[model samples]
Each structure stands twice: as structure tokens, then as C-alpha cells.
Target: MENNLKNRREFLKEMSVFAGATTFLASIPWMKAFAGSDGSAMAPSDRVRIGVVGVGDRGRALLMNMQQIENVEIIAVCDNYEPNYKRAIELTAGKAKAFYDHREMLEMKDLDGVIVATPLHEHAHVVVDFLKAGIHVFCEKSMARTLEDSKWMVDVQKETGKILQIGHQRLFNPVYLNALDRVRAGEIGQITQVRAYWHRNSNWRRAVPSPELERKINWRLYTEYSAGLMTELASHQVQVANWFLDKIPTRVMGSGSICYWNDGREVYDHVALVYDYDNGVKCLYDSMIANKHYGLEEQIQGDKGTIEPEINRIYSENPPAAPGIRQLLHSIEKGIFETIPIGGASWVPETAVPYRGQIIAPYDNNDTFLQLVGYVQAIRNGKPWKNLLREGYHATVAALLGLQAMDTNQILEWPAEYVMEKDL
Candidate 1:
């Protein structure tokens, strides 16, 4: 644990130099939120008491990450499902109190914060309850299953004046941090377009132990609980696009269908969307469960270069040693003055070529753990990171908008009712 802290400090220091800012860390939203009034770090002795609302897969993962940080205590765990409840209690080594109802856990006076990992449909309800109870919250991404509910969550957070950090872990990643800095520095020049996709070949389902538990265990396949690929996968990529572009799209259009997995799933298995931003920049997105060849990627394209942040590589539009150099070498070797063309016929044209990119960030850190630590720090400091919360809010609204556009088969503009007054 000591070594991990040391390495993180060194990595942040190095990235600060790379970003050409002496106060790069201080400029980050989470960092600013966690900093004291005098710009000092929080004392390690200030312990934070936290509870877990849903102890399923993602919730259990957060519990595991929480155990690694110091000066933090898991005071309570809640889940209605017996198996998950038992597993969570076991993970806590029986030290934390157990509850089947989240409302009961909210009665604990000492609980400072809660990690809400319930299904998408329950996010608005559970998160609203916690915020109204005067507890800071770290809820999973996409905010809620519906746009109105998502907006309500944000409004309640404002009314309560409590910290609400949505689960957009990429915002805390070192590689993404460096990439954002580069994009801001014009390394990629004016952003022309962005392309992102998430693909898988498997039927997105879970093994149900009993027939009645199908809805409980496989909630992601039902529209009542999930928005399928759009909210589950595209939300993250669209958040990335918004963060790097520093602007939100004015409108969205898309189409979706249950093309491959037709096992009575309520949501689409395939979706393709186009988000039109200001300055005529567009973000293209697609996902399907029929093929895994392309896997997943968020490709940010600009006039000068392209960045694939998932792979941590950047490709230049015009790489050094092009047709001029290569053709000269070929002509000299062949003892001819005629100009020699590169690969493929000149008239054939090509969409892509082999251009190995440079690595952006080489060091890897556990962003999940870092995000968990940030949440704890924010709780201890008693302040909310509005910028971070707004990023998640915009992404969730964009995804839900895409779903609406697909369902109605019409181009949809950002709704006036959902827009925050501060944004206007």
C-alpha cells in the first residue's frame, strides 16, 4: 500500500510535467473538490464511514476496492437477494452490519456516504433517498433509466448540497488524463469527428439459479431495468467524446433493433447513432453482439491526427517518410527517374493504412481504486464536484436521447425540460 501511494505520486508528478502545467493535478475537478480551502491535502486521520446499497457484481467490486484504501470503514451492506447479501457479508469478513432493505440502512446516524450499485431503474430512487438522508453518494453510471429521473437526481443533489459523484471511472484514469491534456494543447488539432464502438459475440445474459430470479439476475436485458447497449456501453464512450471535445451535441439520431439475440430481450442488441455537435462536428457510434472482431474502441479523430485512447496510441495524419522519401529511395534503387507510387493502384483509393502510432501514457494505475479514494476524500472534505457530476449527467441524457430517437424514428434535439438552467 505504501509503495502504491509512492508510485501514484511519481506518476502524477511526471504527468504534470508532460502536460506543461505546474498545477495540473490541482486543475482536475476531483482534485479541486477534494482540496482544502488553503489548497492542502486532507488529513489521513479523518475516517469516512460508508455503506453499500446493492452487493451484486459491480457493488462487490466496489467493496473490494474500498478495502484497499486506508482510514475508510464499511459500516453496512444491503441487498435483498440472499446469495448476494451473504457474499457481501463474507467479503466484509462479518465486520459490517447486514440489511435487506436500504431504507433501514439509511437510519444509521454514523454513515457518512453510500455506494449505490442497484440496477439502472433503481438508481434514481435509491440515490434520491440517500441524498435526502444527508449522505454523500457514489452511484453507478448512466444516472438513471430515464431522462426525467436522471434530472431529478441532479436537482436533489443541488437541493441537499451533498456530494454526488457518478461512476465515470475514466475521468480518474492517468492515460485519459494525459490524452485530455494533449487534446486541449492542440496536439490533435481541431477535432473533426469522433467514432466509438462496443461489440461482443455472446448473448449478454447471466445464469439464473431459479426461474423467478431471472428478472433479478438478468436485469440488463429488460427495458424496465436497462437501456441495453446504449446506456451500458455507449454512455462511457459518449462521455469521453464530450470531455475531450469540451462541448455537448445539439441533437442525436439513431436506429436500433434486436438483430442477433432474439431471446425475448426487451432492448436492442444492435444500435448505431450519430450525435451532431457545434461547428458541424459529429460523433459516430455503433455496437452489436453479432461479431467480436472489432471488440471495442473510442476513436477521436482530428484534422492533424487520431487518438485511440483505449489502446493509448495516437496516429498522425501524415506520418514522416511518406511517398516523397519512399519513392525517391525506390527510384534510386531501380536506376530510373520516373516517380514510383506507393502501395495499391493510384486510382483505387484506400480508407485505411498501416500506421503504427505512438504510445501516449505507458504507466498503468488502478483507476477504480483511485476513484474510490477520490469519493472518500470528497466525503471527508464535505464538498461536491459539480463538473464531474455534470459530465455524467450530460452523458446519461445523450444516451437516453439516442434511445428516444431510435424508438420514434425521428431526429431529436436536446429537450428543453432536461437542460439545466446553469448550462443555458
Candidate 2:
């Protein structure tokens, strides 16, 4: 009995600190990760009780994943929208209490933590109050709608000493982890540029059941609730660039226009941004709702090789030599000049793979579930990740900087206040 319980505890601890926690699970496409550990679940009384606020699309998905964990019980769900509330409670099979007002749900003293999936603007209040209530909080990314609120989150977490984790699943992704390891190891020669994009073909508008709910349903399309593509899409890659380069962007410039989707939307349909780092490296990002041709990607380019992390492939500029036997035969047959025969087709260097190339990891990367697994485990241990706060804060500020640059039509330097701890 003691051994069994000890093993379970060990596994739970592993779940918390396993960098690229799901790399192995993601590589095994045939297997499903129902829960992270193999040992028996903790007794009901010993389980971690959690609540979820704002059961919108992202929130509901988090609840669904949270429900699958073995010893974590979702105690409550709060969503102002009836449909979203209905959907979330149904996932809990009505075992979890439903509330329209988050204030009421936070009153549960026994709740160990809560997932704050509220709209961008609502985050500061929802998260801060939960922190004050002494509940570990897992808030969704784009920390807050404005810069001051975003920084306040980090400050409050430090002051309160509560577990605060931001939802940027890729930080726990195995593919990115392995790629990050390689980049730092000089796998790709000195890093030069990072390019990222997320493009889709849709008007980006939600159906308004009534005229009153137009802005509420599609909060992502308005400046009041969101920063559009910068917040919605580019934020992920911005963090990746920062992580890979080990520095925040020193300055940023951007532009946008409502090119295709003219459906009474305040945010732009197309956007472009360039963020420069001090070391002559730059992170280039662009997004458009008008085209689906270029789906999404974060491509990191170094002098010797390029890693298209989204697809997991690494391409090389200088390939390795072929097998000695094959090389000997080819050298003899082609007279050692490495030349094309007369009257033959064009001769070209071999592709990247036939020499120095590989997938960052041998798997399809699905990291969201693993990230949540880490969060639940963190709550159990009463300690959160050190980098999660910074990942969420800096990336968000970078996105807001892009928005400011676009709005003002000028290159914006990284704020001096933010630059105090680190060189810009």
C-alpha cells in the first residue's frame, strides 16, 4: 500500500516538471492520454477541487480536458452566456454547480484552483480576485487587454504568493522543446531571423442572436475586448520567438487595414509586424483573415539550417556527405567532377533530408492537454512554473506594442519601465 501511494506521488511530481511533458505521448499517435499517470487515482477526499470561470470556447475545451484527469474534480463552472453555461455544466453531467456570476463561485472555500477563461478585458478583475481569495489560477493567454493590467497580474501573483499560470500550451509542447534545445545547442547555426504567420479564410464574425449580443459573442473582433489577430494568433509565435532568442524585442513597427472582411468589424482583416532584437535578429509576423492558403507556422531560420517548427521539419543549407560506398561508385562513374552528363537534364544539389535534416520530434504535437496536466499538478504541489508568468506577460506586451505601432504609424521602442530588469 505504501509503495503504491509513493509511486503515484512520484508520477504526479513527474507530471509537474516534465519539460515537453507530452513529447512521448504525442509521438505515439495510436495511444490516447486519458490521464497523465498510470497509478490509481487519489481518493475523492484527496482529489484537487477546481472551478472554471468563463465557459466560452477556450474555457469549455479546458474544462473538458480537466474532467479527464484522474484525481482532479471540477467543482463549479461560471459563464455569463446561457449557451456556454449550459454546454459546460453538461460536460460535468450536472455534477458541477453552474453560476452566471463568478463572484458566487469563488465563494467555495474548498476549491483549490480555478481556470480563468474570461474575455481579455475581464481577466484583471477575475484573476486578481481569485488570487486574493487564495485560489491557484490558470488564466488563458493574452494576460489582459491593456499593458498596466497585464503587468499588475505578475505583481499580484508575486505579492500574494499564489500559483498563477498562463495558458500558452506550446511552452509545454515537446516539438518546440526539442527544437529549443537544438537551437540553443547551435544545431542551427547562429540564429538570424524568425518568421511566423496564422492565416484563415473567414469573415471572423459571430452570429448575433439579437442585436444586443453582437459585441459580446465575437469579442475577439473589437479593440475594446481584444487586439484582433495580434492577440488571437500572433501572440503564440511571439512567445516562441522570445523563448528561442532569449530576449524581448527591442522595438516594433506594424500596419494593418480592413482589406477583405468589411463586415462592420473594428479590427483589421490584415496585419503585418516586424520586431527587432538588439543582436541584429528580427522576428517577422503577419496575419490575414482573408486567405487560408498559408495556414499557420513559426519558422526559425539560422545561417546553417531552418526549422519550420509548426511542421517539425528541419532543413539544412550544407548537407552531409553520402555513404562512402555510394560516394566511391558515383565518383568513379561520374569522373569525380560532380557534373551532369552531356545532353542530360539539369543537375542539382541533393535535398536537405538525404543529408542533414530531421523532424524536431517524431510526433504530432498536441500540447494543450499536457499543459493543463502540469497546471493541476502544480496546484497539488502549491508551486507554479517560474517561466509561465514571464511567457504570458512579455508576449502579451509585445502584441500590444504591435497594436500601438499600427495605430500610431510609428516604430515603438520597448517601454523603459519593462526594460529595467533586462537589456532591450
Candidate 3:
């Protein structure tokens, strides 16, 4: 019995020592995946190798964010424009290999994922190519320049077993996340309407040395390269409305004009849209480059209260306080000699009173970085990504519907074919 007991004690001690050593080694960044005794290099199962396409302004920002995430490496970058390609290399500290063509970059065996930030028109081709190559994709918002392109991207995404994360950063924003939680918790009961607007005062003009450069740098001003205020600015609010309502708009109508900044651009400088959902909820969105007055980015008006997701303000209307005390005080101060009706007889029923309710402050984080982190983590873990192709397509379609309604001077019903065809 004593001999058997001694052997059991020895076995337990050895196991404990082995477990401790394994954990200690795992805690070390350099030895994160190894059993230390063998002195072999650790291979990370969670690290995502990323390639960047269209290293323009937004693409460079995405690349910078990706650089800050752990377990992710930027292996390659591609851009058609030479200036953008050079800028991307500078931004990445020249750590990634540069390519003039995206197809070549997609062929890099080391890339586990890619971020597509090309011009609005090129989004579909780039995204579809990367998806079909079995690489996860993070495409910028307004998924494509046209509805057909948006649909095609969705179909390709379904066919490919790769993650497709759209760049609607608000979907991952902490403020929106908390606001969604509060709305779902019934803090603001039955959201019936939403008001959203973005206003900016600018010339809405671009400086281009040549016509070729004009097409490149001033893409937002031309209809051929962009969808004007609807896709560029209103898409964000439309997405917020859809997220909060948990449904796509059933119908859309709006009007837009180039009343200001008449620089011969093909798109509008101001737009207003109304989205009607099947649930009877409505979202009002507007974007104007001629003014800066604004109420809020997005305000959800519910039965009980209102929630401003962008400002992180939530509150219910406060009930008026009784005016009897104020009237009594006024009567006393009047000394009864004036015969002024200052008491309850003269009191007004509706008086403003300070009411305090739940107020949540907005969250502070590099949302761009957080979004990239989620994308990289999902890619490495083989998990589903948020803001998939369908969401992007729907948002784009909604924006385009507003644009069409504006141009035609008619209320546009959501087209049946809008939801049907694939590829733009």
C-alpha cells in the first residue's frame, strides 16, 4: 500500500509540473503556441495574413488600423494608381510587397484575407475576385456603384466559403452596440420613427490638374464614379436606421438638387430621403453640403423615449410638476394687498420641470481599429463576419433608390427587380 501511494504522488507531481511549464510558455508572446522542451518555433493558429487592395485614402487608413492588431500581418498591397501604391507602402512602413494589379496580389499564397477599398465602381470586381479565391474580404461601404453590382457581390459571397465583412464601421462601433442593447431591452419602447441628418458647408469642388486626374481624384463629384450625397453621406444614416429597426426599408422616396456648388458636377449637393418600412416605422435622412445646422446624427423616437445612438443620449419626456407651491409663494410675495390671483387659482397646469433619466455617454475607442480586429479574428478563426454582402447590397440599393427618386421628381417605390438581379 505504501509503495502504491508513493507512485501515485510522483505521477501527480509530474503532471502538475508539466501543466505549469506549458502554461508559462504559452504566456510568452514568442512561444505562444509551443511546447518549450523541443525548442521549435511556434506556429500561430489565430494569426491572419492580410493583403490590401486599392491603397487609397480609406484603404491606407484600414491598413494602418490592421497594423495595430495582434496576430495579423499585411503581406501584400495592390493599387492601380501609382501614387496610391506608393502611399500605401509608406503607410505600411514598406513591410508589405506592392502590386499594381490586384489579381497578382490575390494570388499571394500567404494572404488569408484582403481589404477592398478601390473606387466605388471597382468594388464588385475586386471583392468577387478575392472571395472566389477563398480569401476573406473587407469591402468599403456603398458596396458597389450600382444595384446590380451589389447583388452580384452577394451571390458570389454565398457561393464562396469565405467571410465578407462590409466596412460599415458603425456596425462595430461601441456607441451603436450599446444603443442597440438598450433598444432591444425596451429602454426605449417600440421605435416608431428615426430622424437622421448630416450637414456640411463646403465648395463641394475638387482641384484637378488635368481631365485624367479629375476622374481619379474627384470621383465623388461625378456620377460615373460615385452616387453623390446619397451613397457618400446618407448611406451611413440609412445603415443606422436599418440596424436599429432590424429590417430593410420597404419603400423609399426623396429629392436632391445641385442648388449650391454648381461646378458642373453630375451629382447633387443636397438630398432628403424618407424610408418606410413594412412595420410602419419611418426613417428620415438628409445630407446637405450648403449648411451645418443639425439636430443629431440619428434619433430613434419610441413610444416611451428617444435614443440618439450617435450622441449616446436616451431619455423620456419628463412630467410637469405641480404649480401649487409656486403659486403659494407668489401669493405670499404679493402681500395679498395687490389682489393679484397668484395662488392655485392663477397657476398654470403645464410648466416645464427638469427631468432626469438614463443618460449614457458615448464610448471612446478607435472604431476603425476595433473593426479591423474583429475582421482579422473572424478570418483566422473561420467564423462568420458581421455586415455581410447582403447588408451592403441593401444599403446601396436604398441609397440608389433615393437618388433615382430625387432625379425623377417622383416618389420611388422599392423595385421588385432591385431585390432580384445579381451584378451591377
Best by lDDT: 1
Clashing pairs in 1: none
Measured on C-alpha atoms, candidate 3 has an lDDT of 0.73
Candidate 2 regions exceeding 4 Å error are 1-46, 321-357, 419-424
Candidate 1 per-residue C-alpha lDDT over 1-424 given as tens digits, one digit per residue, 9 for 90 to 100: 7786566555545533543442554567675423333112436568789899999999999998887766689999999999999998999999899999999977899999999998899999999999999999999888999998999999999899998888888888777887777787788899999999999999989999999989889999999999989889999999999888888889999999998788988999999999999779999999999999999888999998889998889888877676667788778988989855665345666647455798878856577776887788788779876477888898899999999999999999988776654332
lDDT of 2 by residue, 1-424 (tens): 5675565456544543444345543332212222344436555665889999998889988988786666888989999999999998898899998999988976798899999998898998899999988899999998888888888887888889898888888887767877877787788898899999999999887788998898999999898999898888888889999988988999999998899988788988899999999998999999998888989998899998899888788888766634554566678887885643442323555465543467787744447766787787677667765556777788889998899899999999999665414312
Candidate 1 regions with alpha-carbon error over 4 angstroms: 1-25, 32-45, 322-355, 421-424
**C-alpha displacement of 31 in model 3, angstroms?**
28
Worst 10 residues of 1 by lDDT: 33-42
Alpha-carbon lDDT, every model: 0.85, 0.80, 0.73
In candidate 2 the C-alpha lDDT for residue 286 amounts to 96
Sorted on lDDT, best first, the list reads 1, 2, 3
Task: Report each candidate's C-alpha RMSD, comma-separated, in the order given.
Answer: 5.8, 6.6, 12.7
Task: Count clashing residue pairs per candidate.
Answer: 0, 0, 5
